[model samples]
Target: MKIDQLATRACAPPGLHWPAPAAAAAEPAARQAGAALARQPGQAAEQALQFNRDASLQQVALDYLGRLEERAVGVLQTLAARRSASAESALQGARAGLERTLEQRAAGLGEVLDGQLRAGPATRARVQFEVAGLASLRAVQAAGAETLLFSVGPQAGGPLAVVLDEHLGPARLLRRFNASLGQAGVQVRVEADSRLLFEIDEAAWPALREHLAIRGEGRLFAATGWQVPPLREQSLQAELRQAPAGPVLRALGEQVLERIRAAREYFQQQQSQLRQQLGGETRAAAEKRRVALDFVERLNDAKTTAAGAPSHFQLNARAASVNRAIARSALTRRSVLGLLA
Candidate 1:
């Protein structure tokens, strides 16, 4: 009999007709054997139904869990994509800001350079004259050499002199020559080795170089036995106060540009790192961004100084470059220390 039928008959009300226990016991052996056989199949059918129900429930639970896991992964991926986008946007903005700042600095530097070039007087020129010595002027004189003559400054009232004479001695000769040279605004100094050096004053340098026109006259110095020593020629020099040329200005600009580019790249890397560490908008992250923005704002403005000379501009550029390095180093130090702490 089916399990449901068996259950229904067992639970019937008392008024139902039924076989007596004595009649069942008195049944023939063949009938008893048939009843035992019928019970075995009914028990197996009930066991099979219970197993199918358990397997179905287990499969349903597995499917439900798999779907839940897939949904969770999808949500996490979406969140990560959003965080990455935000990071990219922030980096781009910072780069744009840095570029703007660099452009402004370059423009300002150019103007200062132009002003420096224009400040000089047309007549002003830079020059240097070097004078060195012979072993002994007395030796040349004792050998009966011809006197050497050289003049400094304009011909009209400039100092002119013959080479050292033996009777005067080096000391006396230097003293006599210095007296007149000093009066003419030219400086003369005797070295440890009795070599003499002459240099014109800055106030009179240009005119002296222009008209003095140092040239050999009959090789007078060579007429001294050992070929009287030759005077070194003077050449134009750039004064410290003079402005640099275009190439120099461009070189300076390149130096500053390189530094600014390095700083920009550094800040960009730092922004990327921050995004990786803190993907979501939180108070701590917001505060850190604010600090970074403050740094950017401070970097936007630069200080420029206008002085009377190009030397001052050089000094200013050096000072500004130093300040930039210090600022960047300080920021890097703070970040590293904060991480370690």
Candidate 2:
């Protein structure tokens, strides 16, 4: 058992004290000595009275000593409290002075750092973007840049976004952001939302599709938020295909998190509910890869409708707004991969 547990158990027993035989003997001896001293100068009855008086005096002295000890304790405590208060005041003054100095410095650099300092955990998932070719690109840094959305380069070179170069797989965004956020009370959670976007090179898109060997009928993709200038037109697209959470660890983690947050355990008493869900939910496996399947499929069909060289007006009239989303790249493959890592 642990020592504290043992101590607790020991406390359950009765606590008791008994004077040692020697101590009891000493008390009696003192009483006898008092009696003898009293007898020396008095009659027998008077000596007995004197003995009681002497014993009372001894008790008074002991009581007085106890009062002195109590007073000493009180004095010590008061002195300690005074010292503590003085130290606290000194510290407060020093802190206030430092704050004043910092305020002055901030005023000197007013409006320089107006950027909001908010950072939090983002929901994580892995994205596999095939390298169209090889070239130099910028990677993200913990203390430097927080995110890298997209980049551009020659058509022969691969993505201008950096990965650790040797690593690929589902990695939690939390691992990279632990020190980056740098606050104790600030909380973080990896959340999932409606959609994520990837911006890829238009020229590289055709090459990447072939390299990945995806043979989907038509996939939805998009690129968005164009400010900086680029070599190609302001657009990119991808052929989305069904992909699995690679490796046993990540697959298990995803399943575990879902199950923990599951509203209800459908097959709590029964067997294989989760397993069945993972494998396939009825005819869904046969259905389009996911819910987005229809949007992209319809959008792609709408894009190339009436395959002759058509007028701009006809193309515009036939185009679905949904296809615009698919064509526009919001999240680049490089950026997505970095978040996953």
Show model 2 residue runs off by greater than 4 Å: 1-42, 84-341
TM-score of each: 0.25, 0.13
- Choose the strongest candidate by lDDT: 1
TM-score of 1: 0.25
Give me the displacement of residue 13 in model 1, in angstroms.
Answer: 99
Q: Candidate 1, overall lDDT?
A: 0.40
Candidate 2 lDDT, tens digit per residue, 225-327?
A: 3223212211110110111212332333233234322312221211133224323522342242233345334433433342323466644543343233222
Tell me the tens digit of each residue's lDDT in model 1 across 72-190: 23323333344566654653443343334323321322221111121121223222354433334433334442344445545436535544444676666667556655565565655
Q: Which regions of candidate 1 deviate over 4 angstroms?
A: 1-128, 132-146, 153-155, 213-341
